[model samples]
Target: MGDDQDIGYAVTAEFYDLLQAETDRRQARRRFAEPAARARQAILDVGAGTGIVTGILLTASAVPVHAVEPSAPMRAALLTRLAALGADQRARVTLHPEPIEETGLVRAVDLAIASNVVATLPPPVRRATWQAVARALTPGGVLLFDPPPETLPGGRETAARLGPVRVGPDLYSAELTLEPERGILRSVFTYRVERDGVLQREEREAFDLWPVEPALLRAELEAAGLHVVQAPHADLVAARRTAS
Candidate 1:
């Protein structure tokens, strides 16, 4: 809906884990593991917010995992989780404090996973980001990503028609009553972020879903000189870069 904004360090820092409450976080990561086992060895998880996929990447295989998350708060949470697992060093993990678009990784990795993060981006930026992914990957390295549905990024028209929906914490659930009669899909993101033992924030960022259709996503990957081995769905895109 707008130019690519950084989303600031604070917001993105804790964004990864928060998204799990709404999106199918586990299945998305599992999708990466099921088809390709060898690709798991050296992974670059783009948009590795708070390490949700980071956690999966570690447990799913005996591979080295590098997570590039632009949000400082999210990195803090990821570090905390990493420390909890006693993986401060042996985990073969590197957490980059930058967005995937800004990262300049040279060696081709076995896999690159960009979850729901890419779908919301405007077309040009998305193209540029995917191109970066392709360049950083080896030929045949899988590129997986998933965009959100029409329920995000301020798709108010659909929300309004969908009517009321409740979401959030066990006790404090956020409620939304859409009036799609006026073309709006109302929703609420109820999540909290804690940084370095400090509870920093609580907020809801609404979405009017700007879904990137699966067909279009596949076409985009192919256009970028990559093979679309699998289409996007439930926040997953399985693809590979073409051989030069």
Candidate 2:
């Protein structure tokens, strides 16, 4: 979603983590940490939004990591998070302030993870990113990515509440809608802040979601010199680098 812009994690990073707090990332990192620990080289965290996954890898494994983040607001939040960690943890990470494709690394890592990002990008961007990520992995390196949803990007967000939180006397909330489409889905996010049940502020952000077919996606990754696997019950697309 970094087509010269942040992934519309709007309000300038104010309510990002709050709305995303529903997930227990600590528990979720188990599968990832296992593979990351066995990696023979550095790890890569593509679209390291706010460094959530990056932090998990740092604390769970001894391996060093390269974190590539392109959004200014998200990177600010990410740097803040990393700055508060121990010196050793900080030293183990190299920050790439650009998109993964533009990061200029070659077969540099043995494991990479792209979560909640790739499916939002259009075909061209996604293809370029896959090729670049494939080139950046060491032989047999594993790339674990989140596959797109059954619905188009913006189509899946419904009026259902995505996440809501209360801080002090203020409360923040957001909702999502998702549907299906062949072209890009323009999802709209509306946020409202309430102070003591009184409406304080309201804002809206637009995000573009792309559609990806599994067959085509698998072919693309295979053509890029990687063997692809989609877990039937999981929302994951795992690709391992193959022999040249």
Candidate 3:
């Protein structure tokens, strides 16, 4: 995660699960179930926010998982989520509080996954992150992820929506701005907490996302000695480490 994304997640962490909802979990599980089921050994989950996909991977298999998350608040939530699982399931996971590029993981994994995470990284960090992921994988290991489309409308101001979600005593809303020239999406999220129908507190956070082009991403993966393939899921890409 970039600094901006970290800030955004920190502010919204309290209500992140509410925003994601059960439907989001179901869809993610459907998308990742096959790959998770195929894992015969260790797996790594990059930017494993709130442990949604991490939980899915655990459910699919008892493989050991290393979950890397950058934001402190998100990691807190992830830990809480993991604690709710069975002891065996919880024991299978190891949490790292570092971004993918900087995570000091010495063990090679059989599979690695990053879901909706690469797009939020700055260019230099994004490339370095991919290289780190490649380094973490064993030869012939697979990497699966979805990068945002390059064709997203560039210069647009999306309408802001207020109170689109109500999570317990809090309400959430977001405003988005897209700058195609910079390949960045800027977002401002608002959180309002109320008690007894009285507003008690309100907070706002900003995030910047840089979505990489598919062609450029493919080139980077190849440069890292991985063979890339477009996965069945829309916008999803799978890359395999080539034998040295």
Candidate 4:
């Protein structure tokens, strides 16, 4: 689950361009359709893995973006992408070499997003991260993010795509588990992938599980002083800070 760092620079790096191509269309639409026409001037993207979301922000809108990412490889890829863009677009991105929870970006932004990023965090961390997102924005700033279906019981079944996993210097056979009852599915087997001797990647994700209903997510947001704006799918949740 924490392998976001590796995926950004290590394994996903080679396929970064391909990945970006596949996601560009959808992100462009979201960028343009995001509500609140006030036109966010400053934005922050948490869990900005490989900066795929970052690239979308740059291409879809003219707003300045601050991307917070922890993976060393992903940050480099993000920088590479920025360098590839037109001079004006390139200047709009400011990279933060840290995770959302740790980022101390001083600017108060109008919007904050932590897309596919939050699903990978542990529960407590997820809550804390959301709190941080709320604190980082100006009054009434919006927070948009998506939680994987595994966040709801019976949702983990969708994560059955099994592939090799990598761990440290040692490699072992592993399998991905789909625990529908837990509303989460994650890598269950040993950390081993083909080619790579020691596993360099491992995933162990747990969401609210069955006992915690998906609607509870909204309650959590409110507890943090944010209100639900829209959640079009089980995979997406968007909210706005309550007016002060």
Best by lDDT: 2
Cα lDDT of model 1 by residue, 1-244, tens digit: 1222444434333343433423444575557655335664578888776666777777766777778776666667878778877554345787777656667875547788886577445567678777878877877777877654543244333222121222332222232333222333323344444444454555655433245666787777788777877544544557877887
lDDT of 2 at 201: 91
Candidate 4: segments with Cα more than 4 A from true spot: 1-9, 24-28, 31-38, 150-184, 187-212, 231-235
1-244 per-residue lDDT for model 2 (tens digits): 4644556564637777777733636533854777677777889999888888888888877888999888777888889989999999999999998888888999899998887777677888888888999989998888997777544443354755755588888898876555455567666677888998898998877666776777888888888888985442265779989978
Q: Which of 1 and 4 is ahead in lDDT?
A: 4
Q: Flag regions of model 1 displaced more than 4 Å.
A: 1-5, 8-25, 88-90, 148-170, 175-202, 207-209, 231-235
The residue pairs that clash in candidate 2, if any, are 155-178, 155-179, 156-177, 156-178, 156-179, 157-176, 157-177, 157-178, 158-176, 158-177
A best-first ranking of the candidates according to their lDDT comes to 2, 3, 4, 1
TM-scores vs. true structure, each candidate: 0.70, 0.90, 0.86, 0.69
The residue-by-residue lDDT of candidate 3 on 1-244, one tens digit each, is: 5553444576778767876646658977887888888888889999898899899989987689999987888888899999899999999998987777777664468889888787777778777877888888888888888875566564666535544476676555444445455546765566666666777777877667676677998898898877896675875789998877
Which lDDT values do the candidates have, in the order given? 0.60, 0.78, 0.77, 0.61
- The alpha-carbon RMSD values of the candidates against the true structure, listed in the order shown, are 6.7, 2.5, 3.0, 6.8
lDDT tens readout by residue for model 4, 1-244: 2344433345444444442444554763564345323446788878666666777677667688888877776677677877878999878878877666677653378788776666556667667777778778888788877654434444434433333223344333434455543344443322234444444455443322222346766777888787897654545677887776
Distance (Å) between predicted and true CA of 109, model 3? 1.3
The backbone clash count of each candidate, in order, is: 30, 10, 0, 11
- The whole-model C-alpha lDDT of candidate 4 against the native structure comes to 0.61
Worst 10 residues of 2 by lDDT: 148-157
> Predictions ranked by TM-score, top down?
2, 3, 1, 4
Candidate No. with top TM-score: 2
